[model samples]
Target chain A: MELLRPDSAEAAAAALGNGSVALAGGTELVPLLRDGIVRAEKLVELRDVVPRGVDGTRIGAGTTLAELEVDPDIPQALREACSLAASPQLRSMSTLGGNLLQATRCWYWRLNFPCYLHGGDTCHAKAGQHREHAIFGNERCASAHPSDPAAALLALGARLRTTSREFSLVDLYRLPTDEERNVTALEPGEVILELDVPRPEASVYLKAMERRKWSFAIVGVAAARFADSIRLGLAGVAPIPWALSSVADLEQATPLLGTAYKVQIARALVRRAVEAVSAPAGA
Target chain B: MVVELTINGNAYELEAPVGRTLAEVLRLDLGLTGTKIACGEGHCGACTVQLDGVPVLSCITLVHTVGDREVTTIEGLREHPLVEAFVEADATQCGFCTPGQIVTASALLAANASPSDDEIRHAMAGNLCRCGTYPKIERAIHTVAGDGGGS
Candidate 1:
């Protein structure tokens, strides 16, 4: 139960050498620690890491979701998705990095069920309640990405600038299978410094929630249109936020039982998001 | 580990466990019962408070992470018109989510004196009221906005 609060990013990354886990915002990590789901002895608090803001095309990973919701420099789709992702209280505490790398919200995992993510041989969601599970990349783990910003980031061509190296935003997550059930590929001691999103011609994010507000996306869509290309990202229907070059790629997605209808919802949302971003002004 | 936090204009150097949540510290250590903890998870805004003038859930907030930020609980709100508006509009049905709702609305009013209906809905989206008093809550917020006592 050792907590290290380093003042600089270098110090923080250096402290994450052993079996320590990085703690940012703690909206996701704290609960897991309290529940005994994660037993890391050391917690490296990254709150003191410098360079936190939403300026120009770069957004510090330490920036909270509340800041992103109102930041003018951010595109409309990212802002909309941020505002709709969680409740006001949660948004104020959840950081951009934590939201991007947070673990699955599946009941089986969070409730300590004997699932593959918990080192069990079988995935309970496949045989149990899986309406909210992934329709793609669900061979061993049926959990969805559960990140609204990740989908929006994928559509906006955002890249993760880590302390060690830079990689595509889509590369952060891995398609979970029995052989490798680890959620993220973030190597030890690698800290997410900031997210770099290239300005796009137009972008939009739309999520279909079970409730009117403050509910996780049943199916979320993020679409961005560049000069002659369009990028689509889908959430709540896959292990990772599914990225596609065009809407026609929807037919190539593998749909699972109990969640096949998500494909239809994703279709409509993708179309609407594309139109919202590509249509002429006041059309 | 010890942490120093300024709550409601008074700085208190409190001794708490490293992993203790702000809500637990407020309720148990400081004896501030106004802040409620419904869902230990961050879903329900029953434990919402103002950290540096922004509404944040105290339940999920770690005690050590608060650092030197100013925390404002329901008890800290001394003379604000939103409190009266809540009573007038009958928004405090069960009074479970009132502190969080008022705190969130205060932040909204601080940022925007007179927020539109859509703005109010979007700002207050995080605080959930199972009592179904949303209409009255919105009315109360509008009532205060109309009074122009924000800030």
Candidate 2:
């Protein structure tokens, strides 16, 4: 185990390869490493490598969730999503970039079960206990994307800049395929640098969690109303942060036996979120 | 890796692995056992500590990533009003979650001297009391906030 503290983003990107992992706030990666769920020969610390703070619509990826939640300049959906994502301690320690890359909270995966995500033949949750599993895109894996902010960013039509290229946030995620078991579309050595979010006319995020505070969403929805269009993104429904063409898309879910109840929660949340963002100012 | 850490107003040099968490260093190496590690993951705030005055879960925070920021543990909060308040308000059951609870509540009160009841609940939501002593904990925080000296 080695620690590489690169002073530049280019250097940090260069250092990440061949079993070396990037360390942001260590809120997600460290625990995975400790539990042996993820293995790395070296850790490239990004505290000094990546940029921080917000400049108009450009938010540096190193910005912490706590910082984003309270920044008045940040969009309402993103702020609310960050606020509702995790506990106070975790929000203070987790970065926006790292939050986007966090793995699923499925106990089967975290417990080192031989699931498809772990390169095993079977997705344990598909046949086993899947109360918290996905209601959509569960053909290959039953895990739900656990990031609340990623769904909000998807609704806001956010674009991300990496060390190599820039792309829409929607392109940053994909359902796990047989060839590639990972959910994210990021290349191995590329580092997330910043995010550009276009301001919307109105936006809101609503989450349904098992507990009132400090719990992962059972169904999360983010709605962003643009000049001519409205976009809705969902979390805890699919292997990736799910974007909906319309509220009717909620009907397309293929839920497992234990996860059938999530479809109702998704439909209700989608309707309410869209309604909240669509309402007139001060209405 | 040899790292220099500023903890509880003192600077110390030590050799630790890159993957070693700050909670491990605080409890095992430095003998600051006041910081508890309940869930080695970040789910539990039992390892809550101050990183430059902001409450963070030390269980998941890598010691090597701490840099030059000062780390304050429950031991660092000597004679703080919250300690006495927790006792007077009967906030502890088994006392395992007290250090972490006090550390988190202290940070909240420091930022907002007169936080509303809702504000207190929101801030202290992370630090779980398995004994279900939340009402007492809220009262203790309110007592220190000078809010009518607790219910």
* Candidate achieving the largest DockQ: 2
User: How accurate locally is residue A104 in candidate 2, as Cα lDDT from 0 to 100?
Assistant: 96
Per-prediction DockQ comes to 0.77, 0.92
Question: Cα miss at B144, model 1 (Å)?
Answer: 1.4
Write model 2 residue lDDT over B1-151, tens digit each, in one string.
8989999899999999887889999999999999998877888799999999999999898888888899999999988999999899899999888999999999999999988878888898889989999999999998889986543
RMSD of each: 2.4, 1.4
Clashing pairs in 2: none
* CA deviation > 4 Å runs, candidate 1: A279-283, B147-151
Show where candidate 2 strays beyond 4 Å. Answer: A281-283, B149-151
| Per-residue lDDT of candidate 1, residues A61-138 (tens digit) | 988888899898998879988988888778888889989888888998999997898889888988888888887777
State what share of the real interface contacts each candidate retains. Answer: 0.84, 0.98
Native contact fraction of candidate 1?
A: 0.84
- The i-RMS of candidate 2 is 0.7
